[model samples]
Target: MSPVLTYVLLVIVMLIWGLNVVALKLLVEAFAPVTMQAVRIFVAGVSLFIVLYFLKDLRWLNKKEWGYTLLATVFGVVGHHSFLALGLAQTSASNAALILGMLPLTTSVLAMIFLHDRMTWLRLLGICCGFIGVAFVVLQNNGGLGTISTGDLFILLAMASQAFSFILIKKVTATLSAGEMTAVMLLAGSVMLFAFSLWVEPHGLDTFSQGSWWIWLVFFASAIIATALGHVLFNMGINKIGAGQAAVFNNLVPFFALVSAFLFLGEPLLLSQIFGFIFIATGVLLGTGYVDEKLKRANLMVHSQSKPPVSIHDQIEAQGQHKAKSDSV
Candidate 1:
């Protein structure tokens, strides 16, 4: 695909994701956080199970492979989603976007530390610069990662769980078909959450309603749109590009989110926001080796005035047929 098309796809992904953040923020008002998420994942898993049932070989998995479903559940559903729900209760939508924006950096670092990934020194420098830029965006008002309030820190940990899950999925890639792995993992996670909701919440299935539309809206959005369709689009995009490239494109999430927030919450758009875009775009480029450190500043200037510019890294990596790293992009 051409670079423009590739980026447009990224924008679409980010926009959907951005809207989700805003939607979820609206959701926590009514639902007991974990209770709401459990419903979402359960329904989402059911949806995928239905798809696979029609697709054939739905029950073809051997017992040994199905064992890994437990691990996928721990990280993907139980660990990640539960923490995110709790964290969302504490953090701001913009804070979530900015912190979650660091997924690429976190993934790269974790891969290097535990999964034996490598990068050139220039790329490393770029990563450092990218973090530095994030620091400016987040802490420009204060100093030293200062924007990371206690609630923000909780959400930050939730983001870290996602990165850790990525590496864990990489280790399990050999044992699972992308679809089977994802479906099984979601099943595991959803079941676990369902049980937890029963045990932890004061009222179980017999519990009274929380609020109007809030519970149902969060459930449908999280389960249907965010879990099922979002993953499908993300993994489909990952197949066209690569996981690393998808990670880079994910840096656009905050941009989408900022717009969503403006539309929904009437949040202010600051000049610092522009700088964050520059740094994130440059970091993605550096991560992919499409541009040098010196060139980032220039590209930043030009792209600021243009329509969303095509990231060359996107074009190069997205070229040719490739398998997706289908671990819930």
Candidate 2:
């Protein structure tokens, strides 16, 4: 796909993910968090399987690929979804959105460590800004460091797990297609999540039948659109661009989620959240190298413009000088 189209698709994925946060919040409020996520992911996995099978793209993994896929599944699907659902159960979708916006910074840090990516001073500053932004949202209720909510902590963990998973996905994508890896990971992780939910919330399965038609609709939308298609497109973007570059698009999620939460869930838009988003957006732009790339381009333009254009006469004179020097030699 063209770069422009890839970027547009990435933006669309972010929008879906942002709205899905609100959808998840609604589902978790009506059902058990882990159980709902397990079922939702199972649906997504099955959908992907059918699509892949029809496309003749589904294939078995070797032992090495299985190892990487399983690890990626643990962090990306099970860990991320488990914590995200649990977090949204206690925290407002707005707060969770802002916290999750730190994904770009977190992914960059992981990439620097695992992939030996360079880290500049600007990126370090961006990381600080991201943390401060998250703090603003996470601590908005308590107004102090000591009283951070468990939900916010869970959200942070979810962000970290997802970021780390991107690094693993990057590694595994060398040997496996993003779609195949994502399908396997989702299916495998859903099983683990189902088991965990059964152990913790034995009656959780019963709540599924209690949801109304609209709730089930939201559940299916979140699964098929947000989880399955979203990840597939996102991983494709990651394959085209690097993980860190793809992650920078996550900055849009907080804005989309904040608006959706307010409009749909009746969550208030707090002043602190506005400020938090500003910081997070700035951080993502800087931390993920977007700003740096722009600045480099700007610098090149300035440097190119700084030099006076050589006249025709000057060019001829230069050529004459060069010829004279060659004759003298």
Candidate 3:
């Protein structure tokens, strides 16, 4: 595909992803927290499971991997979704997006602590810049000190859960296909959320509303579109464009989110947002090996349009090297 078209598709994916925030906030008005998550994840999980079953490649995980998978579901699905659902309910979606954007920094810190990942000076600098952006978000949301921060705190919890989950996922990704893992982990989250809602906060059981249709929109959009389709496309994009270009999409999420809020919710962001982007972009550049990879790719690309270069041997070697680099990191 042309560079223009690839970018266009990426932009569309980014927009759809940002809608997840606004959609959750809207659905929160109609459905109770646990109930909403139960339904959303269940639909998503079931849908993905069906697709995986048909594909014939989803594997039953090994015993040890299952343990990490369970932990991942606990944090990745259960804790992350619960905190985010409640957090979005109490706070504006704009705030949630800004806060959720801290995942990279959170994941980086967690990786260093738990996964023995190293942080180079450049990466640490990027992380510091990202934290400064997070500080702006916190200040904006809470209206400064001596104010309530339940919403901000909840988002932080979600970030922490995500950070924890990322480490667990790194451990498990070696053993499972992304689809197999997503199917199991999401179902686990749905089941737990189902039981929680069934017991404690089951108030909205028979709750039906005309506007609740948006909840399904959030479910399908999030589950099917964002989670399933988004991830599948991500894998495909990774193969086609290489991980570096695809990694760029991760940063697009926040930019699209802010723009969506500006258009839909009348959120007028301050100049501080530029700083946030700078931090996030730089952090992404440093953390994902993009900064270095770009220079490498540029040098390789300059080698030839005239020659039918880059045979299958070269491609395999490059991919193997990339995989080894990821494993070492």
Candidate 4:
């Protein structure tokens, strides 16, 4: 696919995920967090499995592939969803949105450390901007530093887990297709979540039966569209572009989440959030090499324009004139 198309798809994925934050928050308020997430992920996993099976792409992973897939499942699916659900239960969706916006920086740093990707000064500046932006949003509600809520801490852990999983995903996708890996991870992760929920909240499953029709609708939409399809497209984007570049699109999630939360959950929009969005967007551009790529292209254009290419005839004529002048001298 064209780069533009891939980028558009990534943006759509971010929108879905942004709205999903509100969906999850609503669900958790109505049901147990881990229990809801387990069922949601299970639905997504089953959907993907059915699709893969129909396409004749389903197969067993080899031993090494299984190792990586299981590890990725633990971090990406179980850890991320578990913490995210718990965090949203206690925090506003807007707060969770801004905190999750840190993914690009975290993913880029991990990529640099684990994948040996080069770190440019521009990207470093971007990371700094991202931190400042998140600080603005995170500290806005509380008076200042050291007053962050437990919900925010859980969201941070969730972001960190997802970022680290992106690094592992890069490794796994070298040998397995993104869809296949996602399917296995989601299914395996859902099983872990179910077990955890069983231990902690034995009656959690009863909450599912108590939900209204709209709540069930939200659950299915979140599972199929946001979790299943969203990951498939996102992982495909990672496979096409590098992980860091693809992660920069995550900057859009906070903005989308902010809007969605305001509309759906009656959350108030804050001035600090607008400023935070700007900083985070700018940071993603710089931190993910988007601005750097543009600069490199601009430089190449300037150099080409300043020293235009010479034709073979022009070169020969210049050489001949030079030789005549030298002979005369």
Indicate whether candidate 1 or candidate 3 has the larger TM-score: 3
- Stretches off by above 4 angstroms in model 4 are 1-10, 142-146, 235-248, 304-307, 314-329
TM-score of 4: 0.87
The backbone clash count of each candidate, in order, is 0, 0, 0, 0
The C-alpha local distance difference test score for the whole of candidate 4 amounts to: 0.87
Candidate 3: residue 279 lDDT (0-100): 67
* Candidate 1 lDDT tens digits, 223-312: 777767677667667767766556666767787887887888686666665676667656656754445434766888778977676788
**Where does candidate 4 have its weakest 10-residue lDDT segment?**
139-148
Give the candidate order by descending TM-score. 4, 2, 3, 1
Candidate 1 vs candidate 2: the TM-score winner is 2
Backbone clash total for model 4 is 0
Question: Each candidate: what lDDT?
Answer: 0.69, 0.89, 0.74, 0.87
lDDT of 4 by residue, 211-244 (tens): 9999999999999999887877797798788665
Top lDDT model: 2
Per-model TM-score versus the true fold: 0.75, 0.86, 0.81, 0.87
Give per-residue CA lDDT, model 3, range 1-329, as digits (tens): 66667777777777777877776776766777777777788778887888778878587788988999999999988898889887887776766787787776678778788878766766677677677676666666434434436887798798789778978988988768767787888888889987877875767556545445656666577777876666665666666676568767777777777777778778776555656566666676676555656666787877765567689999999999999999999
Better lDDT candidate (2, 3): 2
In model 4, what are the clashing residue pairs, if there are any? none
Q: Candidate 2's residue-wise lDDT over 162-267, tens digit each?
A: 9999899889878788888889988999999999899888999999889999999999999999988887789779878866578778889999999999999999
